[model samples]
Target: MTEQSEMYVLAIDQGTTSTRAVVVDHDGRIIATGQKEHEQIFPRSGWVEHDAKEIWKNTRTVVGKALVDAEINRHQLAAVGITNQRETAVVWDKSTGEPVYNAIVWQDTRTQKICDELAGEDGPDKYKDRAGLPLATYFAGPKVKWILDNVDGAREKAEAGELLMGTIDTWLLWNLTGGTDGGVHITDVTNASRTLLMNIDTLDWNEDIASDMGIPMSMLPEIRSSSEVYGKGRKRGLLIDTPIAGALGDQHAAMLGQACFEVGMGKNTYGTGNFLLVNTGDKPVHSDNGLLTTVAYKLGDAAPAYALEGSVAVTGSLVQWVRDNLGLITDAPQIEDLATQVDNSGGLFIVPAFSGLFAPHWRSDARGAMVGMTRFHNKSHIARAVLEATAFQSQEVVEAIEADAESVGVELTELKVDGGMVMNETLMQFQADILGVPVVRPEVIETTALGAAYAAGLAVGFWDGIEDIGRNWSEDKRWEPQMDEETRERYLRLWKKAVERTLDWMDDDVEELFR
Candidate 1:
């Protein structure tokens, strides 16, 4: 295919806070895009959910709008790729194609007690080592188990094989393929690795773990590679046969989008929270750093590529807190200018341990803490600190990544970054300064969608090799270290003390504190 006449690929990014659809030309230019925010359900304290139907509705609305905006026929689109929030569990009726329960979001802390109980009971750490994930509430297994135990009649139906269980990717794929008629329930390897269900090496549903959770394997979706033709989609008048060629968890897609093919390279996606992924090559680097070893991607069910992932429970949400809860700003993006107005945080550090510190710090009992707060610590300083906190937490993660990589003789010179937070130049610069390395921002910050699209495009003969992806990558800006050594040390010192104070405060249930 020539550069100009290359086929168009569409990617659906089903995120925690929103749903988006983008049309990318063969040249990697975003021809059209549409985004819609869905309602977040907080039925009980520490429990978070989403209406699966609402998610599908927004997906359809955005896809239609994006296709119209690009003035491209749906038939002309070569394929559709899906990149979604991982570990969010959904159970729906197999016959009616309707969700039986709301989607348990990744951010929900409802299954913490169950996770704690299960992690302590095992003789072997079989779940983590084999699945390439921890037995955390953030993963799907505990949440799936929780619903089966608590939700009325759920376990019975599951036993009788009346229910279908899937991560968001599988649920979305089923809907996109015209529901029950399609009879296509599947998940990509990347998303499957996030659930504490699939074996990392075997890349299939593990019987032992399912028996531990008392979940039936019959309810599970078929696991596939990140790229393949899964099924087709049908709407009112449009019977589109677009190949469902790719599906991946969001951060892994961003890794591919940034073209981080070689080992030791990393990408940080600044989503609602933060996710740092380091390509650990084909071998699963079982982390001693409290990081989750996960599938990077799979090439047509071949041996799966692996990565070490560090998840920060809060990053961008700190700013969202100020806007939605504190009413400091009308919008989150405005926090950048407000934060830059202040020279420093005035000795105040906001440790957003809101959802408990993730990655290396696995303490679920941690709570958000603000220290060294004099009366002079106003909104500007608070804004600066919050933004700085995001960088600091990410720095902690990078430290773990660096320390872990060193054991395997890998060195990180730069970090490839994408996601909504990269749009803030101030935060990007601060992240670079704190890490004391270059933070490279790509021209297409929408790397998540692009990653999915590229995978799909590659699967169907649109491209010849991964080198084509690397050649398409171009930097919009590269941020180098700017802060002095003394300032870095002082900031780090304060954050350490602040973190010391936050732990164990959550020893009790978070629902009580939330109330």
Candidate 2:
């Protein structure tokens, strides 16, 4: 048999916007890929939801499509891996395996009131130490608390151990492995960190934090390492006995995808949101700089490697807002062409803290705003400003990472780029120009899926080592800084001024809700 016929790895990437599957060969080349976008539910402002059934429907459809595209039997697959949007919460029945409600997505800010209340009454500082995360609406804990409190009989059922709570990964795993028919409910450490239920130290669901959040200890899923055979693959009519190995939050998986094994190596993924992660080796380096410490990834059952992460609630979504909301551009790709029309932003910067400013700032009252707009500014200038805003956000995150790393004596030199936004060469150059570092884009654009593939491949003996995976990776582009230091500094200063104006815009808007 040919190499293609011998072994293949299947990766399921459950992201913020879609569910996708990629079939990879032993050479690490993607032979089959299928993507399906699903609906986004908005019950109220800042609230987002996805039907768990819809997610599973998409997941099954893509896997079938990928298998067909590869023209291979399911038996050829040696193992399956999964990567997902972290912090998204879903609760389902243990016996019947059906969702109680729509999956509460990570971006949903409905729990903002709960977060505000926690942050005020001496709960923020206390939980931050225990969980290594702030009391934020962006995480899973508040969302879990929301469901337990607001939904009738939900809390009582959960406390009675009739329910199962999980992030997206666990939900997928449970369903894929024949839900309730010996189904497995397990989540990787990376996803667990975003839930605020897991103690970053012990890597287990903490009873103290669970008590504080008012979530029943019984509803939680078992936490597993990022890469290990957690269960079997049981896809209805087409069941494969491949080891269900590897799972992680999308961004953390991308860090491993970039082979950021050494300290100071980092990656910034630009998608619906932007996440910047810096590998800090074995030690879980606590952040004094308003950033979050999270599990990078785990190999087998060993302690999960750690990293510090900073999040921007909006990135490419801002461009989508202008196109989809303002009807400015025909498509998201038009943003690059439109932005290229302007030499500069004409003194405009957009702070898309649509939800809130995360990391380094941690200001929930900061709302989305466009600053320094003048009569000279048109859509082109606005487009340029939007792209530059993403870069400025990264600059802010890097500065925060620098400060935190300094407290622990680590210095970063470069960043690995991935996700949908990095496809624009113009944006990559502008990002490099602003940061004064060579921005490296890998030959593979879908590192999130690839990371999942690599993790699963490792477990099934299809791949040799992490070093082999790194060696197989190739670079497609390298962006170098071309801007003068003076110009860079001038833009940086103006960006800072713009950020200051955005900080407290929603203080009054959120007052009634927080009350």
Candidate 3:
């Protein structure tokens, strides 16, 4: 046996915009990392796609690069865990292992019409009780249906059991486990819950939902616990022979990575989208608020735990738009300095409903808007408003969470945050000020990858238990509320007004553009 100190866990974080591989040691510290960005395909105004082949190739390259950077080989690795952007759907040939169409991203709103059709007279809330998610284009089921209905011969292939379907995690897993040779097609409870086909209580695919969607059950992956030895890496590049031990949707993994084991403890992850999830213990708490109830994580043979998640469709991606589309900034990080140049936004407010508002307001008709822009406002002011937009959106979700938690007799006092955008101290302070709660950041901001590694480590005995992983968490910084209550209220009022303007932008004309 390799010495405990010598063994490491490799976590693959397949996200919406990029694929990252991180190698973590026994102490839950990242030893080395490698990342690759993939193209974001937009077939039309509201449609999004990704080349599954590119993502898989990038995953292998990043994993090999990360291992080489860490000066480690397959022998020193205890296991591999996967954390991915939840709800991105992929359908592929079972025998050949080739994707039938481009992967439909979670942010793609191409299925709004399909979701509307599913809602029917009963409305979007019809599926809320059964699936713990409202009928929105921001899920996997409708995306899967879109592929089957639109892609020629896909429905026939799926019904004939010649094809397999899964989210990004399952796609990576199948390829890593030897694709055509003997790939295991499975997804964790966390990812399955986002599909809108899985029953929250049973933790299995709901036959009624599947039948209603006209989806063949044969195409769905086998549901599994989050932490267990799913299979061994077979033909995967440098990962061959390593145990594939853990699987989690990215947000669930972040919650675990933050050590939010107890109920009411939560963490907010800022990636392509922003998600705030609070551990709701073992039993699922159906939300009266717009937040979606989901599986936090399920270990081997244990009952599944639940979480209430407030998902924002856009946050960090808004920054990317400013850098890419607008060209106001040369790089994403440059926005921080530019925004800092101005003490305030100069009456500008950016409502980034790029993919529609998620959580609290699941309005698919909404569109991005910039209101209250004055002629005197400069690019710095626009940048400030752009950064402030994330904080303001987070405040909306936090308020909704507080309302829901209070209804259930749980009071959330603070927030634990992680993700790439958390590195911006200015935004962190603004978030704290807006929420009027202390925002705490961990010593390691790569919690998404670390969370996956921790799960794999536990399954393979690299770490004894959750307590060992908890001890690895240490606070690096804390931001307290500084703005006066009056000022905060004034800013929030303006934000609400701006959000109202973004709504109903997806009218007949816009809908026609999508088709």
Query: Largest TM-score belongs to which candidate?
Result: 3
RMSD of each: 1.9, 1.9, 1.0
Candidates in descending TM-score order: 3, 1, 2
lDDT of 3 by residue, 1-515 (tens): 87888989999999999999999998889999999999999988878899999999999899989989999999999999999999999999999988999999999998988999999999998788889999999999999999999999999999999999999999998999989999999999999999999999989999999987889999999999999999999863687788999999999999889999988889999877789998889998988878998999998888888999999988999999999999998888999999999999988999989889998899999999999877799999999998899999989988888888765456778889999999999999999999999999999999999999988988988898889989999999999999999999999999999999998888888676656
TM-score of each: 0.96, 0.96, 0.99
User: Which has the higher TM-score value, candidate number 1 or candidate number 3?
Assistant: 3
- Residues 1-515, model 2: lDDT tens digits: 53644879999999988899999877678889989999988877677899989999999899988999988766788889999998999998898888888899888777877877766768565687778898888899889889888888888889889999999999999988889888888888899999988888888888987887788877888888888888887756444676788788899888777888777778899999899998888878888888898889988855568889989888988988999889889899999999999898989889888887887787777878898978988999999998999999998898888888666566766678999999988889999999998899988878888889889888777787888888878889999899999999999999988888887666554656743
- Of the two candidates 2 and 3, the one with more favorable lDDT, higher being better, is 3
TM-score computed on alpha carbons, candidate 2: 0.96
lDDT, model 2, position 464: 76
Candidate 3 wrong stretches, greater than 4 Å: 513-515
**What are the clashing pairs of model 1?**
none
**Against the unseen true structure, what C-alpha lDDT does each candidate score?**
0.86, 0.86, 0.92
| lDDT of model number 1 | 0.86
Better of 1 and 3 by lDDT: 3
| lDDT minimum window of 10 residues, candidate 3 | 403-412
Residue range 377-479, candidate 1, lDDT tens digits: 8889999998999999999888888778765456879988999999999999999999999999999999999999988888886766688889989999999
Strongest candidate by lDDT: 3
